[model samples]
Target: MKLDILAIGAHPDDVELGCSGTLISEARRGKKVGIVDLTQGELGTRGTVETRYAEAAEAGRIIGVSVRENLKMRDGFFVNDEAHQLQLIRVLRRYRPDIVIGNILEDRHPDHGRAGNLIYDACFLSGLKQIKTAEDDGSEQEKWRPRYLFQYIQDRFYEPDLIVDVSHVWEERMASIKAYTTQFHSPAGTEGDATYISSPEFMEAVIARARLLGKRIGVPFAEGFLSKKNIGISSLDALVLQET
Candidate 1:
């Protein structure tokens, strides 16, 4: 199915912590949005692959995305090679999204940067007719390329080229994030290894990052994104505010 937006991440909860608010807001506006996780985060300290899948599914439901797919790539060792790119390319061609959101180019986790490069390369290669991919029905799919590509801010702070005001959907965004019980801020009864993200402090940092981005647009919360190309707007009013 054609999707308006496809958000991809190196791991299951990455998208949730990064751009789920923007996804939620856009879905509310009648846009079809989906998610593609590069890995199941199997190497994560707290959750097993099976549990991560269940949590990811719950998160997808909370975010209101039309689909959520995992490539099942090796969590920490996946490379930006042809085999991995083809996997991403197949999904890109299958969904034919107009816009694509990917992991931060550089982050606290090495996987994030690797996936960012992989997604970027797959996006470019998917547009080439020479690269063949087939759907499950055995029919060959046409080459497709997403028009827009943006990288969501994650563990590391990036000076974003664009920021979307997501203050209105902030609560829902947090709800979706909390859905990954095994990954972050676990409830009293749930058991998990205390990792960097298992504590509530990590979530607080996420909120702080959103707040920092929102300050640029005078909003309570926002999501920041980085783009390789310059962004354009139709009018001066789209500037949000002018510099003093």
Candidate 2:
């Protein structure tokens, strides 16, 4: 199905952690939103792949996304190569999203950076007519390129090119994130050994980051994004006039 916004991530919860708030905010406004996970996050210290799928679905529901898909790329090892690009290109063409939000170009996790670069290349290559790709039914797929591509801030901080006010959907956003009980701290308790993200502090830090970004624009909560291309607005009315 066509999407107004497509959020892609290297792992299952990556999208939820980074851009789910913005997705929720948009979906609330009746925009079509979807998510594509590059990997099952099988390499994570906690949670089995099966549990990850279940959690991802629950998170998608919380975020009000229309569809959620997994590319099944090798966790922690996928590379930005021709084969991978073609695979992602097919999805990009199929969904025909107007805006694509993906992983940060560089991050604390190597997989995050690699997937970011892979997404970057695939989005551009998807627009090339010569890069042939087909659908599941063996029919040829048409070339499609998103009008805008932005990377959500993750793990590491960079001055964002834009920040979306998401205070209205903050509860839904945090609920979507907490849906990954195995990945993040939960009241029910996780089954696997604790890791850096499984700790309560990590969740606290996630909230803190949102608040910090929100403070930049006089909002209660927000999500920051980076864009390689300049963002344009039709007029001054598009600007947020809240006193900062």
Candidate 3:
């Protein structure tokens, strides 16, 4: 399906933690959105792959995405090699999204940074026409490259080229994150042992990060993104003016 936006994450909840609110706000505005998870998050200490798959589906429904696909790459070992790039390219051709949102360039988790670079390279390669891919039917796939490859800020802070005001979808965004009950922290008891992400503090920090980014635009909450390419705005009125 042709998607307006395709969000990719190294693991199940990466998209939710990074850009789910913005995605939800966009989807609620009638934009077609999709998600591609690079792995099942099997290397994680808490939840199993089976549970992560279920949680991811639940989160996708909450975000109202057109599709939620998993590449099934090794969670912690996936590399940015030719094979991996071709696999990602195939998905890009099939989805043909205008905007591709990827993980943070560099983060606390090494996988996040690797994934960010991997998607960045795959995006360029996908547009090369010569880098061939095929559809499910084994037919030739058209070369497709997303116009914007945005890297969402995750564990580490980086100056963002743009910020998406997601104040309206804050509640729904939190719900989506919470949907990954197995991976995220919950006040209620779960089957697995506690991890860094499973702590109440981490959840609070996530909200705090949104608030911090929102403050830049005088919004209640927002999602920040970094892009190496110049971001074009239609007019000056489109920008958020600073207050004295």
Worst 10 residues of 3 by lDDT: 182-191
* Residue-wise C-alpha lDDT for candidate 3, range 110-177, written one tens digit per residue: 99999999999999999997877898789999898899999999998998999988999999999999
Better of 1 and 2 by lDDT: 2
Q: Which stretches of candidate 1 lie over 4 Å from their true place?
A: 237-244
- The per-prediction tally of clashing pairs is 0, 0, 0
lDDT against the true structure, per candidate, is 0.90, 0.95, 0.92
What's every prediction's RMSD, in angstroms?
1.7, 0.7, 1.2
TM-score winner: 2
Shift in Å, residue 161, candidate 3: 1.1
Candidate maximizing lDDT: 2
**What's the CA error at residue 57 for candidate 1, in Å?**
1.1
Clashing pairs in 2: none
Pick by TM-score: 1 or 3, better one: 3
